[model samples]
Target: MVFQPASGYFCRALGAVLVIAATGAIAFAQLTIDADSQYRYAQSRFDSGAFDEAIVEFNRFIHFFSTDPRVPRARFQTGMAHFNTGQFQAAAAIFNQQTVNYQGLPLDNEAFFMLSRSHARKGMFEQAMLDLHNLMAIASAADTIDQARYELGWLHVDQGRWNEADQAFGQITPENQDRFQVLNLQQALALSDAIPTKNPTTAGWLSIVPGAGQLYGQRYQDALTAFLINSGLIWAAWESFDNDQYALGSVISFVGFGFYAGNIFSAVASAHKYNRDRVAEYRDLLNQRRQMPLSLVPSPGGAALCLTIDF
Candidate 1:
């Protein structure tokens, strides 16, 4: 009953297992290093504003390290690269996919925020608002919720929904609320009544008088031109008929009818154009005063939202 030396086959098998495990460990370590290097390189590109290059590097990292923990981050950066390059459609697609695939994760929050921004950049305000609402619903952190509300407020402002904007701004924490108020948003909102608007219906009705509609929209030159043309054609048609020029009179009358109808349509369209232009000018002024100023930047602890104020 004494211990004996193990068999040659057992020793050889043990050696083989050790060799395999060592090889795997080395391979894993090398993979980790490579992944980190690639990620850092991509980030450097992004930081330098070389967005096109950053996109390529980020994609490369994701492709080569699909299972790495940083894969999600790389994917996010790729979406951001597209966004920075003004490729809103591509960026939205990426963020939408990320939000769907990474639901309930921190990445999902970022994806939702970026998706809303992408939609907003494309002037899809409704879609952007929906995205922000979704973010607010899923977000657990106070700061994230505040960020969502802030963006929602801006979207409301973009739509000229002043009351809604105020509500959204009111939901923010008091500390940040003061910053929003400094935009003189109240002053801009007060000017709402002062913005002159033309009723398309009134314009169309006035146009029945040929040029009256245009005058109502304050288009004096158009009114004069329309009135002169309509009157001149009417006179010419009447003169032709008086001279027994039946063919000429009929042709002139038809032409006059077309011009008369066109004048009415022009007035209606002019009124719409006037209103549209006025609202646009107002929004432009608001935009100049109401900058978001908050942006997400990379930090040692995941990411941080930073607000920049320009004095």
Candidate 2:
């Protein structure tokens, strides 16, 4: 047999290796494109406010592309989709899960923020505060840290803990201090002196004197209405009874007695309501809040999630 040149043998082996490498490269690239396309489609739906549909697509992306770098972002976006749909409990659960599962991502603070917001929306105020505290512990960025502090102040105000609110606000660096001061001022007003309410028991006792209880509750118009109606019915009942019209007197007396009882109940209820309204009105005045913008977007920043706080 004729011996082949060494270069020729080497060339044939190299060609075989190149063919296999190219085939593998082509398959890898196709996979990347398919995965990226699916993600972009899901993102487009999310951007269009197709939240329920987007959640399904995002879930599919996570299941099919578990190893993809975009999975973390996909998971976060699913939580956001739930939030937008007003499924706050589900949203908080998803966001909290992401914080533990994808701890190192820059998305951590954003997830925490969303989770806190979800709890707050559900009126789970203590849980919301706890999440905000967690954010404070984990966030090193100045804005993120400051945002947590600011929100904590508002939460304390919501709890009607003005002193705690002031303490939280005091921890702020005074960068946008006046805005916070305005909030604190509202908090102070919320907890400030208010209209004194008549005691319910005293109001019921006064109601027997007809209109006096309502007047004590500072309901002048109601007092006048209650006084006139009660007085007229009692007079009519007395006149019928004095004239010896037994049937008319019986009916009028029954009606007059019912009115008198109703007046007493009304006075006591009104006093209690007056006190509650005083607190509620002030609470409403101090109940203002805002949220920062969040995105799980790929950009020049390179991080999977972005948070842009507005103060």
Candidate 3:
């Protein structure tokens, strides 16, 4: 028959089990404390505008506390740090990953918006629009949908797509309209149509005469320069031909004709530049009038949006 364990052996085994349990509990508490400290340190770095350091600390928190409830916030801050550093592509990637990882959560909406903004910053308008539209489609909350639409309008504005921006703004529910910079934005959009713009085609046609297109575009200096250069070359060519210097005349004529064509192209380009500058000026004015909503306020538990009217 098997020998039964002694009473002393059973007592020693129970003591060892209790000691192990106590040690485990202490270790768990220490881990929690360490995680909290790490997160706090990361947030401090971010608050100080030390984005590079913040990114490192945030990554550390994410790595060490993968199961922590604050992981989502840490991930978001990491992306925001990247954004603040102008690493737009990197920021977009992080935001996009968050959207996937936190699908159906509030973080997902925030991620979508940030991802779209990052894309827009990188001049990836198509991708930005896609993200915003996707958010609008999936969002059931009026506030979320309205924010998505508002951001969509801004994206269109960035691309000079005024009609599209107007449409996007129009889709916002009337009740939520007051929450945005709607009146100024609508005024800006309306003013876009009335802004004086040069027609590239008309400018090109006017350039048939050397310097005429530049003059049409109100580039007086360029017009004068083109006119003088073209006239001097034509006169030189004529004199050369009259003096029987046929080779010199041919060269001068060829150069003069080249300059003439270039003058026309320059005029057309000037007109286009004028139009672009006008649009940029209008955009700048709109920016001056609108109160941009980009400030992030740190809350007790997380970050909150300070303003509702985001650019």
Candidate 4:
């Protein structure tokens, strides 16, 4: 028996089915390719220092595949992108979300650590301490704990809070402390000892004794110079008046008065500046112990980020 020709309607139905199957397969392939392609593009942007653009691409990949295993990594990098681009608040938010939303994930510790940094960058020092505490609370993450404590100590030191710095740095083992040159804690404590502080008001009052004001400000050379110049001018002015050179005496007295007045102001200024410089010296020492430096730059249409991680 011979088979009859297929119907036109039947042929058309089979063609439709084939078209649907082919279209579905292509879509699946495209999705897979897109996830990888977008991830690579995002990474390239980061590597090329195009942090703002990288954030956009990274978020695009994450938005498309929220359930993909790579999503956590994308989330972390997204925070980094914001950090590199100087959107510190945005970075802190992203990192905070990762810690709260991605519990049990490996990125939780990292997220907390980065969150602390973002908060610190925003000058939310108290909030930064909270994040640092959260990072140290991860019992299973010893590495994160060490780093968090270290950064915490430096934060305290930066503010010249020696007691707090000592407390934070004390948590580490002796070996780790030595290895990290944790001597900043020791130095800070040492600096807390009462040292002499010159009072600006007293310095100004002492100016009535000529060089006495500069002497109180611990400017011995300046005191000597001021005394010598004032005395010389006064003597010259007196001699001019004694000789009846009234014009010369007037000029000398006028110039001598300015120097005398300036000396008093200079002494007061020097004392206050000395105190300010003392605080700044401690801060500079703390800066040397910072984990790393971070930078943000404006891009063509946006901002980008760079960070030097030492811890």
RMSD, one per candidate, in order: 9.7, 10.0, 8.3, 9.7
lDDT of 1 by residue, 98-210 (tens): 88754556567778888998898898989999999988887777777877888788789878887787778778886666766733666677687788899999999998888
Clashing pairs in 3: none
Alpha-carbon runs more than 4 Å astray in model 2: 1-33, 101-105, 137-142, 173-191, 194-206, 215-221, 245-251, 272-281, 287-311
Worst 10 residues of 4 by lDDT: 293-302
Over 162-257, each residue of candidate 2 has an lDDT whose tens digit, in order, gives 667667777766675664564555456555465455699999999988888898888889999999999998899889989998899899889889
Predicted candidate 3 versus true structure: per-residue lDDT over 90-182, tens digit per residue: 999999988774455566787888899889889899999999888877778888888888888878877889889888888888887878767
Better of 2 and 3 by TM-score: 3
Candidate scoring better on lDDT of 3 and 4 = 3
Best by lDDT: 3
Off by over 4 Å in 1: 1-33, 47-50, 67-69, 100-108, 297-311
Rank the models by TM-score, top first. 3, 1, 2, 4
Q: Ten residues in a row with the worst lDDT in model 3?
A: 291-300
lDDT of 4 by residue, 115-136 (tens): 8888888989889998888666
Each model's lDDT: 0.84, 0.79, 0.85, 0.78
Select the stronger candidate by lDDT from 1 and 3.
3
Using all chains and alpha carbons, the TM-scores for the candidates as numbered come to 0.77, 0.70, 0.83, 0.64
